[model samples]
Target chain A: MSSTNNQDFLPRSQKWLQISGWLLPFLYVLIVAALYGAFLYAPRERVMGEVQRIFYFHLGSAWNCFLAFFAVALAGVLYLVTRNEFWDHVAAASAEIGIVFATIVLATGSIWARPIWNTWWPWGDPRVTTMLVLWLIYVAYLILRSSLPDGEKKFKLCAVFGIIGFLDVPIVWMSIRWWRTIHPVVIASSGGGLAPKMVHALMIAVPAFTVLYLTALLLRTAMHLHQGVARELNQAVLERGRP
Target chain B: MRSLKLIWILAEKDLRLEYRSRQAFLTTFFFALLILVVFQFAFDPGSTALREAAPGVLWTALLFPGVIQLNRSFQLEKEEGTLHGILLSPVERSLLFSGKFLANWVFLVAIDLLIVVAFVIFFNFSFEAKLAWILLLILLASAGFSAVGTLFAAMVSGIRTREVLLPILLFPIIVPTILAAVNGTQEVLLRHQPQFLVRWIQLLSAFDIIFLAVAFIVFDYVLDE
Candidate 1:
């Protein structure tokens, strides 16, 4: 009976469940298409050979990292303004995804650099350093959330950090960029920029990753909604029974 | 006027506690001095490598130990349950933040000055008038550091394992200040012409102001009951 009441209360979650069920298979197919475009179709670099292929997915994950953090920041602001638990759900989910995708960006870059730069990690790379700092910041943000006692206070503090941590993205980029240019360049390679086929691959990879992120967001938020329903039930019980 | 009195009262209380026990102050000072001594041994004395790396070394010594001071700011409050009594007062939260921030900044700067003297002596850096510039940088950097640090310290003060958690949370948020301070020190100490010194100082000052204002406004949330 309560499960039926939960379904009635969460009609929108049911709609999202249907939408995700329809979308998940399509997203996987897109991911496969992106893989094929990146690996099977795109031309390999003459200078770096096959290792250059990591750029496709590396850049793809980088895009999603920025997108996810921006979503976290936006959701945080919305949560503060609306006092809505759903926005907290969205912010926390996006922040966690941001960390994962950012780690992918850094890891793939490290692997790519090993063969090209003759090192597993190029400490001097501004982009790489910025990504590491961003990774650290988000890691700390996640830890902050988990360590806080479970309550409205936890959500509020996390939201405040979400807002403050967003301030670092620009600073990280600028400081790293400045640091890179200030020192003499070691990898004086030409900018191939992007070939048309490579661009096409990135296009597919970006949306594929984006859709995957959205799917994760949907599922995580749905789970949060379920927990939220329990909280609401407790609150309602207090309201009805107390006074 | 009442707020000013309260801010002073809060800072004075912290200062007196430190003066009596010198727990955070003495330890923070020794921790920074120990870092200099450790690094001093790691490199050859008066080696060119040491000269080149001095600025970065100096900041690592200062900032890491400064974290000790930051953590102590609230840990003391939590220990005595004074934070609860303080928060229950009619005083504004931001004003309370100002008091804590002021106390931390002053202590950090004082500890930093002694470290700088130690740094110069250990590295065999020539004493000169330009040392004043390094002092200014420390002042601005410590202001920015303690502003955010006090806020974060109060935040993590309630949690378990906060002694470890404080630096993890504090460092990333204050990266720009660290970068600016370290770079500014590099220009001041290492370079002859020192063109970028002004730019780093500008960044440091800008971050100090922006973070001070933002932390003040945002602190009310962290202090939420």
Candidate 2:
């Protein structure tokens, strides 16, 4: 429903979507293959056995969560400077996908942690708690948008929240470091946790998950842009009817 | 000089109003106190290990009261339609922000001091070493929190669900300051080495400056329309 007025920008956004859609399947297949190689083929850990296989995917997802929030911070600065809707869309889209990835990270980390650390939840670990907090914050972002009526106010409010949320990253990192310092490190030895084959399997799995993450983000943004177009047109029609 | 004068006058007006009604402070303090009591029950107080949890408990107490006080700070302006009147004034709108943030910071800090003392008594935590350093960090962190808080409260003041929305928006960002303050205070209570507390204090100062400058700039934009 977009007009030709912004054809240049609109088409690129559509193209990104198309390309992302094409990439998702290829990326998923690559990840599945990598997981297969890592789990079944890779030499099992002497200590963790089958469960060490989850580490590669879990680490990859955690890496993606950090990247997502990093993008969000950049989006915040750009939105502050330009006041453009495009960057806001990018931020909102990234945050949504980031939350999804973070959820996977949390779940998979727990699964991995249980077999190795012998605990489902590890308290005072900075990374885990920070990601959870970040997940909650962005989830609150969605809730916030729903609570506000549609208008400029919603945009500005979300933008401010986006910028402010950047402060949490460093805090989370530091809190973890401090927490680690306070707790006595009783388990220093992994006891020959990873074999060469297992490490090789993880290398393949890492990038696969990252590519899948980027693909999902691009696809989500494309659909969001389409919806924005539909909304503006509806508002235009409603305004035209009033006069 | 005149603008400074205006800032003070507005701040004094706010303080006087709060002094007369006292509801804002009363409710905010009560809210904080109630949360503190709740946290005591939420955890096992009989255990000696509970003392280390003091910082976390202090932060939770401060967080809710901070939001409640922020929401009420602008309620008077909204009720009297004085916000619009103030907007019409030639006073640099940022001054209005300065006034509001100052008053909020002052009131919150007062409430914080009481809570910290209560926290010490309840937890039996020692605050013997580096008392001044800890107080400075707390005040700086309070300034950082209330500065952004004042800006957001104004931004959402026009919205229907501002009451809930402010905390939703404020808490995520405020976590860092809470981290610094709580960590720094923990160091003091534990009598950590001076060098360690210095680093946390430095972080608090950096946070204060960055957020204050941000709110100062962005506040003008928010107030304009």
Tens digit per residue, CA lDDT, model 2, B32-121: 888888878877875755677777788888888888888888877988888888888888888999999889988888888887777777
Q: Pairs clashing in candidate 2?
A: none
CA lDDT of every candidate: 0.84, 0.76
Q: What share of the true interface contacts does each candidate keep?
A: 0.56, 0.37
Docking quality tier of candidate 1?
medium
| Candidate 2: residue A192 lDDT (0-100) | 48
lDDT by residue for model 2 over A40-141, one digit each (tens)? 878766666778777777777888887887777678678768766676678778888788888998898777767677778665566666777787777877
Candidate 2 local lDDT, residue A49: 70
Candidate maximizing lDDT: 1
Positional deviation of residue B84's Cα in model 2 after best superposition, in angstroms: 2.5
Stretches > 4 Å off in candidate 2: A1-10, A186-200, A241-243, B1-6, B38-52, B92-94, B117-134, B190-195, B221-224
Clashes of each: 0, 0
Q: Interface RMSD in Å per candidate, to 1 decimal?
A: 1.3, 2.5
Candidate 1: list runs displaced more than 4 Å. Answer: A1-9, A189-192, A227-243, B1-6
Single-chain TM-score of chain A, each candidate = 0.89, 0.86
